[model samples]
Target: MLDKIYVIDTNVLLQDPKAIYSFQHNEVIIPAVVLEEVDSKKRYMDEVGRNARHVSKLIDSMRGKGKLHEGVALENGGMLRVELNHRSFQYLQDKFVEKTNDNRIIAVALNLLLEEQTKENGRQVILVSKDALVRVKADALGIPAEDFLSDRVVEFNQIYTGYQERFVSSEVLTGFYKNNGIPIETLQCGILYPNQYVILKDTLRKSVSAVGKVDRSRSFLKKCAFDNEHVWGITARNVQQRMALDLLLRRDISLVTMVGKAGTGKTLLAMAAGLMQTEDLNNYKKLLIARPIVPVGKDIGYLPGEKDEKLKPWMQPIYDNLEYLFNVKKSAELDKILAGISSIQVEALTYIRGRSLPEQYIVIDEAQNLTKHEVKTILTRVGEGSKIVMLGDPKQIDHPYLDEYNNGLTYVVEKFKDQQVSGHVKLEKGERSQLAQLAADIL
Candidate 1:
């Protein structure tokens, strides 16, 4: 097979700095304009800045062996080149302005496509980008373009739902109920993942059913802790919510991921469980609740106030859920309730970077707005005896650079599917209200 050449855009590098190494046995190109663009974003205060600095370090380390302008050899037998002189304004003069980095990148890809075509060197040149507009422009200009697909973990249909349904013989169902547990080998199904929830139905009579969790290490099908567990006056409204409650209330499962749509009780139930573990049960030292501060649309400027006052608007939804949990009627009373309980701490993910939370119930709400790296950092901050719960609606993400498949919550769910210490639940029903559920379905 002929080798291919891929010209990567700046956004691709920023989305994942190690993306250049993903294309196996293929030549990689980085336009000079992309480096300039990456340099400008290194001053950012978020993950983008961290990625920019990482890309810089990667390129700097490559410079020790050879000049980047004259291609360097990667360890995987691929060539890496920095295209320096492709910022010409000759291509797409009428359709696009040459002042932008996107245009410059397109120009680089166009020139390289022409050069490779003229030489007929048994290679195809394709432009790789994460921006839809850039790919559209490339298609219009007759240059081949594709999305960078390294970070996408799974398709929506292929994503693990953390629960499975299997039909078992009536005898097995009876045995499970009589013994309160069953040996996994007797089920006659394929091997199941650790911590995966399963619904066992009687083949003859589907009405006789049971829900259990697969503990592959112990080789047993233990009944889930759903029937008797209640969190902060909230009971499971459905089977999915019941499974989520089982994962949330378990001390053995250190990390939990919950993905659902609007009004699915993802955030509310997580906060309730955190409260139960921290306040009522005294299982943890504090209930630390936070969420990423991503705006829905164009951000207005910063609000003027102190820390708590500034966070009031961004964190109002969390406070609203707290009010529902505390049954407080007013803001002053909520303040008094919060003040009276030193076991709860309400904050934002912005200030959680450099702290080690020990014996705490950390609830990360709206976690779909976070990138994979940011989520990793947050999970690693979990100290001994701490439980971390991340819950989000993948369909309601506000982060511009993330999507349903590549968001951190989904990524963690997919990655930790088989691990013994991790558990995930996808709440399907919206239990908030009839109106909210209908609105989510149509609009």
Candidate 2:
């Protein structure tokens, strides 16, 4: 089939660099303005900057194969080129002179489409982006525009976090309680995925039931393994903790979403599981962790100092959990523990764009702070042999446009509820401390 020409947007590359590859055999067109925009972001020490650098490097390497301005063949059998079109609207430069960047990008797309239309057997030119307003403007201009569907989620309501409910016979319920165990093989009839918590209830009584999970070994609740030793000296104190452990340890449920109030141990449990899986079990090659840096109000502007220094405040929560898990007092001690484990990486979400990660355990904390588009971008980065756990409290969202029911975390839960590969748990009990729990409940 003849490849379609796709005009790549800066935001799309900023979200995922390999986005160019997502088009499969399609020809990707990167506007010069997009590269210029990416260049401006390349110096910052965040996910976006990192992505810009990555895309730059990718384009540079491709130059060895052929001219980047002309086009270069990708390993995936596709062409990538930088489009240099400054001709857009004649009045755009004067009317929206201040909005130079956006106008230039739109101009590139419009020019590409117009150029394509003049061809004898012209191919369609689609402007692919993660920016919504850009799409709106493209539509107004009669250009074919679309949100980068590679990161576009299945649906706002189709993402699942892998928890389910099932009705079992009274005998099964009685057996589960009496023996405190049930074989996985016997439960497979209703079990969805490993680590999925099942609310097994008696069909007749409806109330007689228990909640249990299928273990990593695909065995029933009776034979599942639970890491009793506290991760970094922190033990699972409650049923919710146990549930968290189950979710973390299970191999089949690659996507786990946990929602809870402040003291619910959501982040702690996630970190512990990440540590255990990445450090102890070596189930995955690395533990890649990140969270959106959505401030409560107006922007804080650019941060100063080295990458670690700038990220410290934003990553304090992750460090605190690590400190507790490693049973260390000093920051240096925790740093050493982290250093000893090369696979563990705590990064800002800003840098994760435009990278393809495989064989790693990823954790996105405070996910409620991310927009639907951002969440979709992060999830699509999951390659192979990877598990991504998104933990957050929807009610405590920091994103201005998002709310309890509309946030990305909730969106994932509602969307992927029926999928066999995902799982979700609403951590209810607050185990932080009496005061903290009280504050969480009353406040």
List, residue by residue over 1-443, the lDDT tens digit for candidate 1: 42998999999999989998888898899999999999999999798999999999999999987999988988877888999876677866777865687888998888788777778464788999999999999888888999988889887578888888999888888889888889888876676788888899999996888899988584889876575457788888898898898888889999999988889998888999888888778899999999899987889779998999989988999999999999989989999999999988889999988999999999999999999999988999999999999989877888877888899988898898889999998888889999999998999
Which runs in model 1 stand beyond 4 Å of their true positions?
Answer: 216-218
lDDT of 1: 0.88
lDDT of 1 at 286: 94
Query: How far does residue 40 in candidate 2 sit from its true spot (Å)?
Result: 1.1
Q: List model 2 lDDT by residue over 72-156, tens digit each.
A: 8877888888876445666355434555677777787777777778988888888876778878877878878987655544445
Best by lDDT: 1
Q: Quote model 1's TM-score.
A: 0.95
User: How far in Å is the alpha carbon of 355 misplaced in model 2?
Assistant: 22
